[model samples]
Target: MPPAPDDRPGPSRNLAVDFCGVSRSYGRVRAVAGLDLRIAEGEVVALLGPNGAGKSTTLDMVLGLTDPDTGTARVLGTTPADAVRHGRVGAVLQTGELLPHVTVGELVELVAALHDRPLGVDDALRTAGIGDLRSRRTTALSGGQVQRVRFAVALVGDPVLLVLDEPTASLDVASRAALWETIRGQAQAGRTILFATHHLEEADTYADRIVLLARGQVVADGPVTELTGATRGRTLRATVPGADLDRLSALPGVRTAEARGEAVVLHCTDSDRALRALLSTGPSARDIEVTGADLTDAFLALTADPPR
Candidate 1:
């Protein structure tokens, strides 16, 4: 709608995706609205949003199962449907979408055979971390195990672009970490990967760029550092001489200030900003310290939006 991709310097120079006011709607509910975005090659972008925030819809558009009623989605310079058949694009959708009656091995082979040159059954299984589950029926595998099979399907094609929608859902922390490692391995292999998830920390810990979406539109997009800022004002303990920490807590954008031991640990938007305010509090200010706000604090501050 807005980008007018056909009017640009063609797909080769444009972003991996060229969405100008792209949107999809069913009846009165708009799953996605007029949205414009660009994803470059080899970019690992994590889509983060609340439930029903259109994350799944966005992935579907990228996968070509659902087309936008308004605007369009281009995967790696090609329409998602054509991209699947010709361009390099892979996706593990929310539904798993596995053929229940087939053994994992058969499914793997079927997908691999789609390409003129595909990975060996053994190699796909090995790469997908499901070598041991080759003979298992797709319907019988555990969620994590099935998830691995889904990856095997997406990956066996050797697509240049990979889309994972909530790839770590229903996984425990350990499983989630293992899944992350696997995805990182793919990224290391230089695949342009885009994963959608609700977990901020996972996006922070794994993705190269965090693309935040809300209410059917992109709210923020950038490297973790760019979105959060330097230092992130780490969570630090500050020992101050004052009992009235409310003045310190009330500092603008200071998320929380709690007294611990002889100091206080503050979670805030700008740790530097918070630090400066705490230091100026009359004679009661003493021993002000600083620490780093991990991804949580950074994400919290970045995604913060005024009430609509």
Candidate 2:
């Protein structure tokens, strides 16, 4: 008797996904240029970048849907195609076209049948939070429901590594949050996951590490806290009558300052110093408040090009 699918070899202890000197080009445009990224087993990593940043191309290479023009893309100590063929890899790409007539349950079960060893259909459904929608026709489901079903399909293979491309792109706030919880749960279960998204909050909140891409190259890579801290600080807001916004902007530890009605908003590197300066130099300074930087601020500042 053959080993069950669940008994197949799991992801190796080494890299789950590795790109070495990989490059791809289309006509006159370069999609990925001399890229190198290594994702270890059982890690949750986010590939973050704006449009035209080669994120999709990188995922494509990892999925074996496209070949790198110059170098190697490896998964699980083997080619991506080999890993996928052995049921070690699973993915939810940006676009999915579910059959209209099949119920969600049937669709997922069908996908499970294609793999050597797969999770029980019901288990996949429950994991994806779509068990209640099992009987619903695929065509009748809402966008979020469709995504959930697709996630179930991805899990049916019981893959060791999962890839999701902008899984929450079309979801509303509530759906996005719900799906994020599911993804986090998967990561916590020791499954390696790689997702690509432009949402700063998603990367910051859910991933163990963030790999920031720019113009087809890795611009930053590190733990979420360190990467965000590199570009983030406290913000100071105060109601200062007849505020000298220019002077405030030039204050020590203040990155930028602007006036909004009677309030001056300051993006600060050192909030304590900024506040001290405000009180000592400006007679009208009052109603001062300081806030820690959120992901949005860090993302923008990190992605911004530095002065020449």
* Top lDDT model: 2
Error of 1 at 92 (Å): 0.7
List per-prediction Cα lDDT, in the order shown: 0.78, 0.86
lDDT of 2: 0.86
lDDT by residue for model 2 (40-118), tens? 8877889998788899999888988889999889998899889888888888899758877899988988899999999
The runs of at least 3 residues in candidate 2 whose Cα sits more than 4 Å from the true structure, single-residue gaps closed, are: 1-13, 232-234, 269-273, 306-308
Task: Give the alpha carbon lDDT tens digit for every residue of 1-308 in model 1.
Answer: 11232433344664666677889988898878888877767667899877776889888888888899988678777788988886378888888368979899999988887886676888878888899998889889888898889988888888888999999899888888998899999888888788998788888888877777777888777676666653355664577765566776788658778888777777777777776776666446667666665566665655566578
**TM-score, one value per model:** 0.81, 0.88
C-alpha lDDT (0 to 100) for residue 300 of candidate 1: 64
Measured with C-alpha atoms, the lDDT of residue 212 in candidate 1 is 76
State which candidate has the highest TM-score: 2
Reference-based lDDT, residue 176, model 1: 85
| Superposition error at 58 for model 1 (Å) | 1.0
The RMSD of every model to the true structure, in order and in angstroms, is: 5.1, 5.9
